[model samples]
Target chain A: MRFNDKLRLAWKKNNSLVCVGLDPDLSRLPAGMAQQRESIFEFNKTIIDATHDVVCAYKPQIAYFSAYSAEEQLEQTIQYIKTHYPDIPVILDSKRGDIGSTAQKYAVEAFERYQADAVTINPYMGFDSAEPFLNYQDRGVILLCRTSNRGAGDIQDLIVDGVPLYERVADLVANQWNKHNNCLLVVGATWPEQMAKIRNIVGDMPFLVPGAGAQGGDVEQLVKAGKTADGTGLIVNSSRGVLYASNGPDFVEAARNEVIKLRDLINQFR
Target chain B: MRFNDKLRLAWKKNNSLVCVGLDPDLSRLPAGMAQQRESIFEFNKTIIDATHDVVCAYKPQIAYFSAYSAEEQLEQTIQYIKTHYPDIPVILDSKRGDIGSTAQKYAVEAFERYQADAVTINPYMGFDSAEPFLNYQDRGVILLCRTSNRGAGDIQDLIVDGVPLYERVADLVANQWNKHNNCLLVVGATWPEQMAKIRNIVGDMPFLVPGAGAQGGDVEQLVKAGKTADGTGLIVNSSRGVLYASNGPDFVEAARNEVIKLRDLINQFR
Candidate 1:
């Protein structure tokens, strides 16, 4: 199934908009397991088993795995998710971009190797970096529109032809690049007003809204301002707040409770 | 030694600006050897052995290695270059960027795992993505400014503060991000005017100029417009024109000849 349709199904089936970011910092992993690669896979498996029913998707930040030289473990983690939670879509939050052939290889790495349902891309190289990801008709390509970082406005807020650079990026992605209906924008929940402007520009396209809980973004405002007319177009991600809710043995249960709280809060806003 | 000083030492020792890109496409590999990961490493060994003396740096585009799931071979290739040709620097062309924590992991991936002297990064996320790489006081952080691709102008050409987005990027990289003196800019040789403008913005700072030969970039114009006042500070890259110069057994010699030609052409302009 195309990622958009698959996302819709997952969204409705779970009746949730929470996307748990699986960014396993080794220091934060619970005690007893050696910091080996398999330990990460084990931790991810536990997290997925605990929270799959409450999430619309699982977004794995590739850097966490690559940091430990654990791409193999990451592969296994994704496989575990796919096998156990077949209904949940996996979005590899790589944000990789390059020229033509290199982008093609990255596309292969994300889609074919990791079997992600979608991937994020950086658009700094213009269409050359994004076209290869977009060519994957079944996978979604989430472009980093207005990032959640503190200094995201250094370039993204630069004015261009009476529009900010991020808005221009949204316009380009909407009018030019979303031909396959597989394009998504990443608008941080930290900037709910900007998210609303971006939503207006991109219309009903889904926004992978990071920075909801741990990053102190007002989830109520995000759901009220950034949600689509159907109330199911925002994937509100909370990484540390959910994953590291309690690093004790109750970590999985804490994660479950956190996701339930975030989901209910989003639904109340909707 | 810091990356900028190391780059200068290598540039002067070799008296050349050619950065041979090791983008080994399996389909384009020479016959007579099985297309395996080891063969890819062997091919890189030959190319590095053949052209190490006439070049300032070796840039192994990570996508080429990741395409074959041969990051191990890539690690070995960098180790091989460091062992045999310690004077020459290796720029791993990753173009990676993410938030603060993720950026920290990617920095480890490039500098610790791959041991690249330098790595490319996308600057769209503002400082959050590039700052971690910059914090490596001795390693180089080359940011994408004006790319060589045909569609590079999509967002980069958008006017911000009456200057193009790329120039603004150049200004920001020079003024705000180069406090550690480890920052470099990537201005494509394909756009000599933009290259000259960026050079003027970032005076005396090094520029990794790709798109030289097969990308239809003018080598002489790049050397004349991009070089520092001392006739150095440009790392001109040519991938296909050098790596795929010959698909026969004489591939090594052909690659050496191509590098020599590019280096001499650059020197002549200087």
Candidate 2:
């Protein structure tokens, strides 16, 4: 299935827009969690099994697995996700943006090797850097617009031609990319006000909106900022706010509940 | 030996400012001269053998090698350089710039995996993204400032708080990075005026100046633009113009002559 259609189906079947960020920080894993080589795969599988019906996608931050000597484990983690959580979209949050050749290698890693449904990419290198991802018709390439961080404003909010860099990026990710393949723009819920403007600019490209929970972004305000005639194109991601809700044995169940609550609130707005 | 000291010694031995670019285009190699799989390494090895002592450094553009599926061959090619030409600085021309964790992975790839003496990095990510690279004091992180490309002025020349983006990067690479590790800057030879201005901002941080030969950059103007007090901070590079000097069986000899010619002209100015 096309990534967008699969995402739509996943969103409806799960009754949620919550994406579990599998950022397995070795030091930050729960107190009693063992440090085995396959600990990440084990942790991720449990979370997927418990919360499969309460989440739209799984977002894996590449850093956590890349830090160790067992770097091959990252490939195994993705293989497990593709096998067990096959229906749910996996967004490999790599944030890569380089020249044409290196960009091509990353495209292979995400699509051919890891088989991620979508991947987060940095847009600093301009159109040439992103062209490789746009070649995959069945996948989604989420370009960073206004990221959920303090320093995002340092560059994302810069004014150029009376438009913010994020808005300009939204236009490019919409117009230029659609000519080739699927594209999504990342808009943080913290900057809800920018969401409405971005929605209007990009028309209806799917938005992977992050920062809806512990980051303290107002959910109601964020929903108001992103409402379209079709109310679809929004994936409000909550990682730490849900996955790390409780560090005990009930962590996955606690995560499911948090997702359920957020989904209910979002359903009301829809 | 430390990277800086090795670079200085190599420069003294070479009496050459030239940094031969190993941008091995697979199709351009001599017929049956090893197929595309290991052609890049095969070609690079021949060039290095003929002219290793004539150049201070060897710059391998990340895109060229990445364009092929021979990741293993690329790794082997680099290992070959590090093994045979240990003193010849191999600056991996990968303009990678991303967030903290991913940046750390790239540092691991460039420093540990490929074992480059210096890796060109992108500075659009700001200091935090670059901090991971700076933490590796044993290596050199060359930040891209004012590039030699036509579209470079699109972003790098942007003024903020009374200083250009390139100037801001230079200031940050000099001040913030020196706090942790050794840092260098990339100032393209095509932009002599920007090179002179960036030299002032970055002081004596070695500038990997590309764009002299096939790229139509003026070497004499570049030599004038980047000459340091000790005549040490410029490693002006020529890629296709030097490496592709001839396509026949005598290609290596022709390639060596090209390097010798460029090196003589640069030394004359010095």
Which candidate gets the maximum TM-score versus the true structure? 1
Candidate 2 positional error at B195, Å? 3.1
Where model 1 places Cα greater than 4 Å from the true spot, the runs are none
TM-score of each: 0.99, 0.81
- Measured against the true chain A, the candidates' chain A TM-scores are 0.98, 0.95
lDDT of 2 by residue, A104-176 (tens): 8678767876788998887665676677888888999898887765556656666656677678778867877
lDDT of 2 by residue, B1-270 (tens): 667777888899878889988877777786558656667777888888999889999888755664454556657777887888888888887777655555777787688877888888876546766778777787788887776655465456656556666777688678766674478888888899888998888777888887788778988889988989887789889988887899888888999999999999888887
State how far residue A84 of model 2 sits from its true place (Å): 4.9
User: Per-residue lDDT for B52-148 in model 1, tens only?
Assistant: 9899999999988876788888998999999999989999999998888889999999999899999999999998778999999999999999999
Write down the worst ten-residue block by lDDT for model 1 chain B.
B29-38
lDDT of each: 0.91, 0.77
Clashes of 1: 0
